[model samples]
Target: MYDLHCHLLPAIDDGPADLETSLEMARMAVADGITTVACTPHIYPGVYENTAYGIRAAIRAFQCELDQRGIALRLVEGADVHLAPDLIEGIQAGRIPTIAGSRYLLLEPPHHVAPPRFEETVFDLMVAGLVPVITHPERLSWIETHFDLFERLAMRGAWMQITAGALTGRFGKRVKYWSERFVGDGMCMIIATDAHHPRRRPPCLMEAREAAGALVGGEEATNQVVIRPRGIVNDVPPSDLPAAALRTCPRDQRNANGPIRASVFGRLLGRKTGV
Candidate 1:
């Protein structure tokens, strides 16, 4: 499998602190069935402060380490870019790194609160000809109340990537619940491991894929974890990618008023569960 989001670079951000830990993480990923991993270190300006050039250099060094260790995992360049006012300027100046230098960018929203003009900023990035792949929205607190915002973003050509751990209840029951809901409702397009270490938040997705397969069927679950991710890394357009057989809840199982809620093991197939 190809993991499109991971923090495997050493001393770059909140990932591994040294090369040894990074190498260990790489081995863990390979054992977990991840052949390719995008080294998406955080690019928060005042915090991580990772520039495109620096990220590229870091990826090169890490790749060499993997090669020397005889690890089969491949590292690609990317940034978990925090939303900012100067985002467009940063992209224009080539200071922001996209996934594998493709048009796909891993855009990370604030976890505590939704930023002001969030929709406008996403649209502006789209207008600038960049595909903003929203990372881990199921973990966002405001999504429970403003879930429609995500549907709108999808209509505007944005892609949503849910963390693999979120599906296995690693973040919490709430995040896991929403992750399943989003996948069933067809809002989420990819699953990635936002892995930070070898043990805690480790690089793994097979278990999550099995969990997702129970809802969307084995085939569609594979599309989320493998097919779409490969397309994003290769800069493939959404129309050209494979379609997911979205499963919906039975009519009697749906809620009457707002969103349709699915049981923990039940399918919420094609129905539109409102925000």
Candidate 2:
């Protein structure tokens, strides 16, 4: 299987801190049944600032080490770019590398929320004749709150990627709920590991695929979801969302206790209010 988003490159971003850790992570990925992975180090302007030349050089160096170590996994070059006003321009000027040299850019929206210019940036990328493959939409609060945004993004040629851990509920129930919704809505195009380390964020694509099967059923359905992501690196469109029933999840998880008053705050407020 092809993992579209991964931070296996050492000393680049918040992934493995050194080469030893990266090699271990790579070994873990191979063991987990992932044959290919796109090394998506951060090219976000403010946070990482990695250029295509720098990324290519890093990937080449890493590949040499892999060959020497006899690791069979193939590494591809790409960037996890945060939406910037100059992003579309940078792509046009050949500054940013597309995923595996495809027309797709593995876009990383802001952590707390989808960026305000998110839709416009996607539209711009489409107008620039490139496809915008958004990474981990399940983690975004905006997408969780408003499912229509996902449909809108998809309609605008933006594809959604859900993290493997999210599907396994490693991120928490809310994230899992949103992820399941996307899968059901035919909004999710790919499920990737996004693994950073060997222990905490290990390669578990197989586990994720198994969970998807339990929830969605069959290997073909799961592969249809996963293959499109790998195809991005080769400049292929992901297969259409399957017409099977998406797993159901609760829409509202609110409680009747008025935000379920926190213990410490409740004690302090109780003393103050004499209740």
Candidate 3:
């Protein structure tokens, strides 16, 4: 499996604090079944200004460590870019790091609300010929509130990625519901760990798979979601879902502010229940 989002770089952001921790996280990832991980530190305007060159250097250094340790996991470059107006300009100037240097960019939106400039950002990415693979839309306020917005973005050719923890109910019940619903409806194209550490935010997608299996009544659909995400990073197309099988959250269920009430309930309940 491939962990599309992670803070594995030493002291870059809210990830590992040192090289040893980074290595330990990598080892844990492989042990938990992740083979490739994108070192996506925050790259919005103010949070973490991780440039492509710096990100590459980090990946190279991490790769060297992996090689020295004889670890088989591959380290790739990506940016968990925060949503900001200037981001589009950065991408055009080659300041933002694409996933594996592919056209796909891992975009991170604001935590509490969807920025009004989101559509414009997508337009900017399109203008620069970059395919924006939205990272962890399940956590975004926009998707939580306005489910149709996702369909609109998908219509605009942007792909969606859900965090592995969200699938396993690690993010609470609302996230699980969103993740499962999106995967089941074919609204989601990839499932990544988005891991940050060995324990606090460990790397694992088993819970996501379990949830997918339960929802889809089989493993094929769930596996398809997990496999295609890595394929996108590797420049492979995802398995196309049949029109009839695809689903969208009911209009009434979507949130205009952020997550729907069900999601809030699920999350609250999940927190209360704990993992």
Which whole-number lDDT from 0 to 100 does residue 252 have in model 3? 77
Quick one: how many clashes does candidate 2 have? 1
TM-score of 3: 0.81
Give the worst 10-residue stretch by lDDT in candidate 2.
Answer: 258-267
lDDT per residue for candidate 3 within 239-267, as digits (tens), equals 24221123323557545652222222233
By lDDT, highest first, what's the ranking?
1, 2, 3
Number of the top-ranking candidate, with TM-score as the measure: 1
Instruction: In angstroms, give how far residue 63 of model 3 lies from its true place.
Output: 1.1
Off by over 4 Å in 1: 248-275
Clashing pairs in 3: 144-258, 144-259, 145-255, 145-258, 146-255
Tens digits of lDDT, candidate 2, 1-275: 88878999999998999999999999988998888888988887777888888889999999999999999989998888877778887877878988888888888887786567667778888888887878888888776566666677775557777898998888999889887766655566678888888888887788778777665455433553455765676676533433223333233532443112121222223421110
Residue pairs with backbone atoms closer than 3 Å in model 1 (clashes): 247-269, 247-270, 248-268, 248-269, 248-270, 249-268, 249-269
State every prediction's TM-score relative to the real structure: 0.89, 0.84, 0.81
Model 2 regions more than 4 Å off: 224-226, 238-275
Clashes of 3: 5
Clashing pairs in 2: 228-238
lDDT of each: 0.85, 0.75, 0.71
lDDT of 2: 0.75
- For candidate 1, write residues 78-135 as lDDT tens digits: 9999988899899889999899988899999999898899999999998898989999
